[model samples]
Structure formats: C-alpha cells, structure tokens
Target: MPSTRSQVDTLESGLPYDYTDDEFDPDYRESSEEEEDEVPKTMQRDRAKWIEDNVEDIEFLYRQLMRDGRSMFGDSFLQTGTINTFANFLYRNTTPFSEA
Candidate 1:
C-alpha cells in the first residue's frame, strides 16, 4: 500500500481534480454505474432519429434517381445495341437531379 503522507500530499496538491483515495468506495462505483446507465437511453433515441432521417433521405434520392434516369435514358437504353449507344446512354444518365 502507498504511504498516507504521500496520499495527503497528493490531495493537498489538487493534482487529481476532485478524486482522492479516501473517496473510493462501493457507493462511488454504484453512482458511476447509474450515470453510465443513464447515457444509453439518450444515445439510443438520437441514433434512432438519425437513422430515420437518413432512411427518408435515401428513399427520396432513390425515387429521384429512378425518375430522372428513366427520363434521360428513355427506359430502353438497356435494349439498345452498339457500345457507342450504351456509352452515350450511360453518359446521359450520369447527371443526377441534385447538383450537390
């Protein structure tokens, strides 16, 4: 075990913020656990909200891509023959509705 005189000196120096050797007990552990448990509920709610918003944005982008792609490619680019035609079709479909 460490010397009490060194521990007292360390405490007096205030080098460890609010912590000290004397404060370490079962009650401290229980309080820390309770604080930790409180965090997950808030984090889970934020995560769920973030996922919901992202899913909505993704769906919107998918629908927009489908609509604009069909318009630019005439819905029959896949059926067309020749590499040039397919290349032109691909190039034409490259421009998305959103600039950014």
Candidate 2:
C-alpha cells in the first residue's frame, strides 16, 4: 500500500506537461501561426444609422430614463429592470461609450 505522500505524488493530471524547451517555446512559433491565433477585428457601423434605425426604441427608452430621473431623483429608486436596460443599451453602443 502506498503512503499518503506517495499517493499524492503519483496522482495523474493526464495532461502533457514534460515539454522540451524547444517544444513549447514562443520563439519557435511562426508569425503566421501567431497571427492565426489572434482575434479578428470587428467593423463598426455608423452610429447615425443605428440611431436612425432604432429611433423609436431609443427615444422611448431615453424618455423613460429622463422621466424616472425627474420624478425619482432623491425621491424614489429606479427598478433593476430599468437600470439593466440602460446598462445593456450602453454596452451595445460600445463605439459611442468608448469615445467618451
């Protein structure tokens, strides 16, 4: 029977770990190989076009935010749904927020 120390030492990870210096070295990677692993850049659409397309929804949401602010500021709290909707709108409009 193995001792606790021996049992612990013999436990298998089953992953390849005994790589040679040359095998997993970064210098061995070709430029193309590194490039292939990189994330591709996404193109930005026109904000004006986005606003134009989503005008009704955006205006409705913006009005709701403003109304809530006017009536609730220091008087009442906003619902989590309202805050989440605003946050999600900001998240989706990345280019506009990133510039700010």
Candidate 3:
C-alpha cells in the first residue's frame, strides 16, 4: 500500500507548477487563431439586432431582480428564476444566430 505522503506527492507532480508559459495564457494565442475566431460583420449585426429586440424584456427582468430587499419575493427565488430565464433567453437566441 502507498503511503499518504507518496500519494500526495504523485498528485502534486501531475499538476502544473507554473502558468506563465504561452501555452497557458489566452493573450498568447496566435494571430491566425484570433483571426479565425473573429465574428463576421453580418453576424455581429444580427447579434446587435437580437439584443435590441430583447432589450425591453431583459430590462424588465433585471429591474425585478434588482428590487429592494423588502420585496415580497425572497432573494434566492428572484435570483434563481431570473438568472435561469436570462440564461435560457441567451441560449435560445444564440442557436439561430450561431447556426446562420
């Protein structure tokens, strides 16, 4: 049976000790990769349009979530439901735009 110290040493050896290298830094990503990942103008326009269309609904939900602590709804209830709705809204909007 392995001793606890040896097991811990093995685990530590498998982990990265330094993250300063380029491979671990997002800002060090190659220029070509950045270019390939850039969103097209049309897609950007579509995303902007989608946001504009949903701005009112987003604002309304946000206001409800930002209400004073004395409101009838509990913080947990408001946070959970509002955040879930916002996430769902983003996911639904992304599907159409992303596939285009």
Q: Estimated TM-score per prediction?
A: 0.24, 0.32, 0.36
Error (Å) of candidate 3 at residue 19 is 2.0
Question: Which scores higher on TM-score, 1 or 3?
Answer: 3
lDDT tens digits, residues 1-100, model 3?
8666633423356865555477877678756734643455667666567667778777776676567432765555455445435534564455564532
Using TM-score as the measure, the top candidate is 3
lDDT of 2 by residue, 4-94 (tens): 6633323277644445556578679546733532322332244445556766777677777768776867436454435335533554555
Q: Lowest summed-lDDT stretch of 10 residues in model 2?
A: 36-45
Task: Report lDDT (CA) for all predictions.
Answer: 0.47, 0.52, 0.56
Please give the lDDT score at residue 94 for candidate 3: 59
Cα lDDT tens digits for candidate 1, 77-100: 444344333332333344242111
Task: Pick the winner on lDDT between candidates 1 and 2.
Answer: 2
- The lDDT of model 1 is 0.47
| Count of backbone collisions within predicted model 1 | 0
